[model samples]
Target: MVTTCDIIRMMNRISQYRQANRLLVIMPTWVGDAVMATPTLRALRNLYRTAHITALTRRSNRPLLDACPWIDDILSAWPPQIKIQRDGAQGGVFGVVRRLAAGQFDTAVLLPNGIRSALTTMLAGIPRRVGYDRNGRGFLLTDRLAPRRQLGAFVPVPTLDYYLAIVRYLGAEHIDRTMRLFTRPEDDQRAEDLLVDAGWSRQIPLVVINPGASFGDAKLWPIERFAAVSDRCVDELGAFVAIGGASKERPLLQKVIDRASRPIFDLPGHGVDMKVFKSVVRKASVVICNDTGARHMATALGTPAASVFGPTDPAWTETGVAVDRQVRVDVDCGPCQLRKCPLDHRCMTRINPQMVFDHVGELVGWNDELKHKGQDQDNSVARSVGYS
Candidate 1:
């Protein structure tokens, strides 16, 4: 096995000149940010057209990377949480760094704004290192771009746009904001089968509800609010609901499912791998989620999505690039981007459940009164035709 340090040296030699053909990308380890990095990956593909682009990311997020077409290779950084865990797991980072150095990448784009990502790319000795100038890692990066804007009072942008800025540093003239993931046709078939197995109607529009956000309390919408919106979808449109997330979020997912009066197919802890998960979202008519990884996944899969934002500004990766809309309450104190709320999480709590329900109704392509009237008209037509 090649050592990461040796790989770095080799990559540096190959990349000393402009090879453009062999480019390596370092992904943000966080699941949400990993998805946000998709636009950057797409921008690279757009610029190079024929370059082999490999992405270095955490092992747990391999499924998402595997399903993405923009990535040529999926390099795993085991214990993807290692950086966040460095205070507890310190001894093995050098070994991990060494393995990374062995890949012989020409150009390295670091998506995570942390010192660790830049240091790893530097340690790997990739010739060209690119990232934002933050976290005191400016010396490690060869290309540092200024952040587009500061966070505002209530305007939330998505994180994907921030990651795409690196592509500009690589000389990309046109940057597309649409995030993308690719799935095999068989994967879509499998998801359809799963839906049928769960007694869901494939013909009816599908809605995926993800009630968890991993960025702590910064981006979470109230669970009760999620349930309220879910119930309206079921009662009004008779649409099938698929609740998805990892095993860790099951408790919160269950709470939303329990509050919903309509029956929902709970896929929490359902071992649906990333490919299948992408397929699931692909078949969904719309996705309702917090500003979590799944929201980005839904956009990549081309599912119209409504993502709620709270503490984190959506400026880096704005929602609705491919989704229909991003629903955030106009709270005066929101976009604080804090892990924990200093003021009782009022930003998220004040959003009325009715507001979410109203948003859902809009996406389903009808207002509440319009839906009722349409149903009444359909009933009248059936009665006039003597079919009822």
Candidate 2:
């Protein structure tokens, strides 16, 4: 239904922002980037309390913010990179442009650094466009921030801060870099039902492991290593271990389960949507995952997490607030930031199970003394795990 003709017509009818009563946020296309953009959204909400704040993101990433209180509503716009090359959705590039145009937003905030984002907002007839001036799109922005770079490439700034700089440019003073997320009651109830059905007792401490990374296989740690860690949690820590998958990571999740000695509770492969998936993450005492969006999900939910890093730089995902437990090995080739590994995948492979399990133990504080002593105190577990 979204045609090039409709898109062009909308652009021709461009109107300047008088009061910016209605605002549109052009969210990052990737899930990890989307999660990192939460603080910026919160800042926008605080600054413009009366304005209607709507987030425009990819269809898949849209569900992750279902319970986010900062935005009034969210809409999906599927572009080619995700729609055509990866996810088979009907909304092509033009369709996305068309949908964004129909929103009639006053001020648009471009989150992703892609030139396509700047171009689309301009085509949507959004006056007062704001974004980082990168990829030769400075001419398209009404207000643009020059990116910080070293020799030639941009610096590996923490993602939350990288997004928050735009908010500062918009005249925000006090910056809160706290990454946050929420879950619905219905989804929590559904998660409770499913967790119980899967033999997870409410009394047992929950440890969730995400073996899959949507980024690429380069970010994945060995499945056998994950299985070993799961078994350690069950045997040593006396915890209920669960493994989850995103959309296309079911087989990877299954492999972790198949190789494990103990029974692992399944989260995503059980037909739960991203909303329900988040509730499960919230209920977890500690989460273990690959360097993916799930790592940010856990942090946002205030659940202590342990992450395995490989191909990507840890500097990119670092939340300025929390000290997360991360397991990685220094290899010559990485953090190469490659989607696929060309040679031996030594960065991830060398990080053994014990390395991850030790950190998980620290995050969980699984011993009986620490558990019983800290039950009544606020953030006692977090304090113990050094989350703050």
Candidate 3:
């Protein structure tokens, strides 16, 4: 005679054999990682054309995917949408469990390697859970893929490859790893309105300077360096320079404008969401930013972009955009991958604005002018994050 436990195990085995008619996806928390996961989303759609897919993501990143046609629904795990008591956060986790359980998803695709993501899907009773089996949660996933590692440390592969590996396990055959993003009509109109309000026209080249980094102060290249670049672009290149930051980061934008010699269009006070932000980035002739979400955003739109790297390793975000470029000053202590610097932050301080502009100049096609003047393109930052 089979016991209750034996019956439940048998049911789970049978459920794993069923088709993934309804799917739930747990998106990465960081904005760049979420954008990187788009390929996986697309691959899943191509493989299961009729499956109703609901993606659970942070509230801040929901707007990024609002215009994506492949996803059927977006659920927020963050607060305000699903208000959680600060004192009783466990209640909120259970609340998420309840909501996910009600969806009755047949399979869950965990994009992040966090154990919490695995445990949540496991508790939701999703029959088939797929994810990288690390972080002591291998038991939570029914289909586990060991992440590429060397000597017990995870290898830094491109995020596009890391996220796509999950879908490939499901028999997806997406060879095109190019990341894509979409914006609504209103998003485009809003970008235009912002430009028009700032005395910008299509005649002038638009250079979008991203000054604020959500990853923390360690990731931030000096704001004064950004100001210098903006002034040079407007004065020398005859470009319309615009600085962007989150609402909280608006003050950083003001600081750049205050230090800049020429007028800079400020995009922080306008309450720009990710959708509107995408339209603005898409329209930019070149985007210069720290290693942050804007870098990935520009990559997705196929916009020429240059980025400054600090504590983080550049190897983690290879999007296969041939035009994309970056610069990072070499330091003994980094890429330490620390959120905040314990030392003097020599990694960011050594990188000067000109080193960055060299890459930006190349992206903007300054070949003829630079060559005419006979300026050497070689620089210190060119050695690793090359094309300086």
Per-model tally of clashing residue pairs? 19, 0, 0
Clashes of 1: 19
Error of 3 at 144 (Å): 1.0
TM-score of 3: 0.86
The full ranking of all candidates by TM-score, starting with the best, is 2, 3, 1
What TM-score does each of the candidates earn? Answer: 0.80, 0.87, 0.86
**Local accuracy of candidate 2 as per-residue lDDT tens digits, 1-388:** 9999998766544432234678998888777788889989999888778989999888888778887889998887644343433342336665666676787788988888888888877877888898989989999999788988999888999988888987776766697777777778899899989998877875677899988887887888989999999999999988898888776788888999999999898776678788888888877778899888888888777677789999999888887435366788899888899989999999988999989988887777633334576452223344344445
How would you encode candidate 1's per-residue C-alpha lDDT over 1-388 as one tens digit per residue?
8999999987765543344767878888778788777778888888877888888777778777765667688778643344444443423566656666677776787787788778767876787887888778999888777664556332334676667666765667767665567678788788889888887764576788988877786677878788877777888878888898877888988888888888878874566776787888876767888878887776666555677777866665664442345677767786777988888787788777776666666655532232345432121232232111
State in Å the error of residue 71, model 2. 0.7
lDDT of 1 at 141: 85
Point to the candidate with the largest TM-score.
Answer: 2
Better of 1 and 3 by lDDT: 3
lDDT of 3 by residue, 265-326 (tens): 77766676678888888777688999988888777765668899999998899766666777
